[model samples]
Target: MKAFKTSKRVLSSLIAIMLLVMSCQSFLAADGDEKKPLNIPEITLENLQVRGGSTTYLVDNPPYSETAPTMRDFDFGPGSDNMQDAYIVYNYGNEVMIESLTLVGWWPKDQAVKNISLEYFKDGQWVTAQENIEVPWQTSGGTEEEVEITLTEPVTTMKFRVKINSAYHSWSDKICMHLMRPNGYIVTEFKPLTDAIAQAEKLVSQVLIGNKDGEFSQDAVDSLNAVTNEIKEKLDAGLVTADDIPVMIEQIETAIEEFTSSQNPMENAPAAEAENLTVSLGNTAYLTDRQISTGMTVSFTDSENPAYLTLDFSGKNLNATGLTLLASSSDKFTLNMSAEAEIDGVWTEIAAGTDFNYRCDVQGTEGHKITFDSCTASKFRIKINSSTAESFTVYEILWDGLYDTDTSAMDNLINKANSIIKNPASSDYPDLLDILKIVLSPAENQETSILANQGKIDTITQLLSEAISAFDGLAQYEKGDVNHSGSLEIEDVTLIQKHIVKLLQETDFFDEYLADVDNDGVISIKDATSIQIAISSK
Candidate 1:
């Protein structure tokens, strides 16, 4: 009885195996002769939408009279039952050669696929290239397992046949294929103004998300946020507004390209250190008579060049008979003397490229002292160097603490002096004198005149400010009204005519302000005629 039971069990197992084999054969032959007719119609696509960059395509069976061809229905059972078979055809549209191809899907469970075969159609005939390209069914499917079959020569059609020599575990769906092509684009960079607007709009969209009903719409909020951030970052950092966007983008892109090309960072580092500027100090021709007895050196060398250097003297009335080059040849010396004196005494040697500077010390004083001696040297640069009583390394340093002043004052003074020299009675000497008095006076005593002079300054400032404002306002108005009729370009020149008539209505010559190009304030036929002339010409 035990022997009979064993035999029966073996028979049952054999019968099950036979049934599985039949099922596998049926799956492989599903698209072959012994199957119901597939009613799905052939479909083709033309003029596909391509963004000219990274794009992907998937073979999606469209909803139609039939469910369409799918690999899910093909069942490849456990154990070596029957051969598994599947075929795929791809056509290269517009003669574009396929750079790369990949087939992807979940792995089969039971066993691995024995091989894959490829065929190509060319010269009006089909040709089989490979019959056994191995693919492991138990392994995961991705780009890693992609079979790179290089044709070397161009072909119009590619056919792949996946064959299962042994039964493997089933997969939920058939594998999908992807063909990759490098990106191409015509517009490499964006327009500056347009890019700014787009960025603003994007920010607005993010900030106003889900706040559709708020006072500021998503777009407005984004625009304001973007513009505000841009102003704060760029303007504060001092970036110029008129720079071209493409130029900047190209620069950044070029940097990226260079980094990618070189790949080695240290290769771009500085090869060697740079040389420093040489600077030193030397004695004046004649050390002050006081300096002679002080047991102190009147000269020094600027140890740290490109560094600030200063010299100071205080206490007892310091006096020097004369200043001499003092034997050492050097290029650095600047001095401020209270009394006119000789620079560098006899027998002292002056070096090449060396310079001597002298000025009066009036820092906290009412005025400066006159020079007592002559500065000896064939050549020397003499600068005011400021009346402040501080040793400054650079000339610009002396102007640092000064309050903002009208640089035009100097020009005005010079002009006034010239006018006085030319025809003194015809010019306004009092006004010129008043302006100069404020300029030449010591800083401590400048308060009263400054306060009294504010109104006159304001009048002049206002005239200039108003003229500029008017011109800018008119330009902006015209820009906004691009239609250019008097409105923009669309409507009649109503505003223009009104302004013209207003100009004509002005009567006072000196007091009333109008487009009095002649400065003779009365707005008469001349102003009206000027407007008329401009309009006619336009």
Candidate 2:
């Protein structure tokens, strides 16, 4: 039966060759014109025409249709029934020389095309260029097997045909011829560079000049600007090609790195402190530094008497987001811990943990972190609950959040006061030195004080200005000494009152400027009252 089938295939090929010769001769006679072969760099679907096939299977399924296949359409065929006689002819519409043909087979080892014969039409006759070419089965799942056949001598033809002699399977007659191409395929698609370039330009525009956060140095900014401009010019002039896109993108990336690396980091602000921090067991407060410092530990071995730590920012608030506890146990034990924040006089639990058997290994201390949504509160507490531990040491505790206060005003005031103290106008006034010394200390403290608000800073500034004014007044006339008696006394108070009731004229008073004791631009009962108060206090 196999010998009979082989004889039948040989006879079928002979008959097909005769028919192809007749068709070619008829096509040549119809044209009766000789023309030069087209200079096509590569064959593509647009230029190639495909026709002729046996009955197709699954032609209506997706990625397959009744429509004829093109040069690179991979899901072209699975010739049904008479697989040995199935043939496909590809026409290039014009004569072109092809050096190699690549055939991609169907997936799944059994359904792939196995053997094929290649024939080309030249000199008005069908010529067998290659015979019995074997295509390997696609054994690698989901990946197509491509077989390339390099011709012993390159062939020039307007059309070629591939005869599907056999497939690996014969039961279902399922055979597929996936793709065929002269030479290899070329992809010409690329993503547009406009969006990427625009994004880089936007970053450059947002850069600022300063040593603060999000600011860059002028040199870095300038360098980035130059690079961006050059790239933009090249893009605008259409000098950039699809092949150049990756290199251009890399250049922009390098420029961004350089710009970021050139930034001057912001100066680190001093660490903030709570207004009052205490660690206590019940009513008794621990006398430690109440902070996370080196060699500091608040340990309690008795599980019956646990301790809790509290941080009070007075009336000020912190936007608390997270906290860390650096703790270790002397033995294997479970240390349960929890935290709460005071909101509107109510203590609400924020985070909790248990089964922490953290021990001091060779790596030193280990920290457990608890993170939660940010909460605005003035007081926070960490409770070390009852645990089965011989002893546990808390080396440190750190809070992560922003202190909910803007101290820029107080900071500026301190700077101004420091300038005045460093560059004194005159050293003769010991009283002025004393007053300034009193003003400078509190002003400096407010710069980092969590309790410092704008209202308090404004009041302090007003008071300091008044003190300097009174010091200046001493050089001219004794403030509040309206009687010129060389002292502030009851007579000075009486003269201010008599002058207010028109008994003594303003011209009769000694230094009427001194009579306005409060420097409120008026000599009235208020000045008399101020003098009396000063005398009584003295």
Candidate 3:
């Protein structure tokens, strides 16, 4: 009875947190929304031209148009050896006060200069940000450079001309520029993600099996927290990323509620869903939610990139008959999506790519569906060949498929892994990690063949069984004790801080499942701040 009481108390508190959070979301959203909109007149671009640089070293990028940056190498024009010799006159129809000006060089670091200086028209006057900034500066993200410059004050002008007499670079001798911008976008469409998380958390405690301290599944918790972190990353960058937020949040919520599904596959099993597919472009994980952008989806990739992306189901032993590629935007574009299969590691295009058409603001026909011969070979690849839109954004990839191997045992293992990850004891770390590897088996770069490959589906089941036999039982853990030190201290806060700053880099510190002090699904910097405050109050 006492144990039941304790469990009830914890749950009651959590429910309260959920309710309070939901009530304040509207208020929070309102706070972020603009109250008094900034008044600014419309502006137009007129006959703009480049001047002075070495006319011999012409920068070729198409000026102020085209979604894809089409400027050829050495696009910065009228290129004289003198950097000041090159600049553009931006003639506008109306004069407006712009808060900032940023010149974008779509490349990575090391290849471009980090800093630059130029004089531009402001209030009908030509001036530079720093009179002392005489020489060229350095740069980063060499593959795609985004150089941002902020002015001391808003520049009011009708016509602005910049003169760049010189520039500097550490790697490539030539400088190629992309686009310039005013400021980053602010996304207000976040209610879907927040509402989904809140609803899922409200229901989770009701489904938890045991009364132990870390009774809930950590994997489900981590999955929720991971999305939370990814959303934070996008918001910090000031990017509008809510297009797929509703879908992603829904998928996660479904994953959380999987326990509500029937345990017997015969009764009901997980069908082929859109979430299983992986995407990338030539060697780089372009659409992968793994980086700065939400691993769930990305903005856009230049279809013109010779090395395009492939969505593959090569190692899952799953034979797919058809595919559906989703476009985030409604604008009509040539959809160059194709399905290919590999025989002896060679890819043969199975479906000829076609144009994908959609009318923005129109209903239906937002995705392109392709049918193909069913094959389970590891070489199956799907590529977005090209699009009418210079760059197109493909968010979700869905397929119709079935596993060749028996999945009864696999499903059972997945359930067990989810359970163990949610409430791991101190000694469950090694096995917990092994379980993760199994669930995420047949990962990219795994050997291609079943005979020589260690990534076989059977291997995961066998490893999972062994790990289960070694369960270390459960232990109570303080919510902020990330290091499993048995007590919450200043060091625990520091460890989480280090993880946030990229100093420690360990993502599995939350095995105890109690490290999420606020139960927001994420162990973010805010959690660290909360811990410090808790310590002070004590």
What's the lDDT for residue 126 in model 3? 70
Candidate 3 residue lDDT tens string, 445-471: 122333322235567667666665555
TM per prediction: 0.17, 0.26, 0.27
Report lDDT per candidate. 0.29, 0.54, 0.46
Once superposed on the true structure, which residue ranges of model 2 sit more than 4 Å away at CA?
Answer: 1-307, 313-316, 332-334, 354-357, 385-388, 402-538
Best by TM-score: 3
List CA RMSD, all candidates.
32.2, 22.7, 32.6
Query: Which scores greater on TM-score, model 1 or model 2?
Result: 2
Model 2 per-residue lDDT at 430: 69
What would the per-residue lDDT of candidate 1 be over residues 411-525, giving only the tens digit for each residue?
2333222222233332344654444334333222333343323234444444333323322312222221212223322122333244446643333211112233233334344
lDDT of candidate 2 vs native? 0.54
Model 2 clash tally, residue pairs = 0
- How well is each residue in 204-323 modelled by candidate 2, as lDDT tens digits? 665567666436777877887787788667654446566787787787778877775665543222222211223231111111122222223334634465456566666667788876
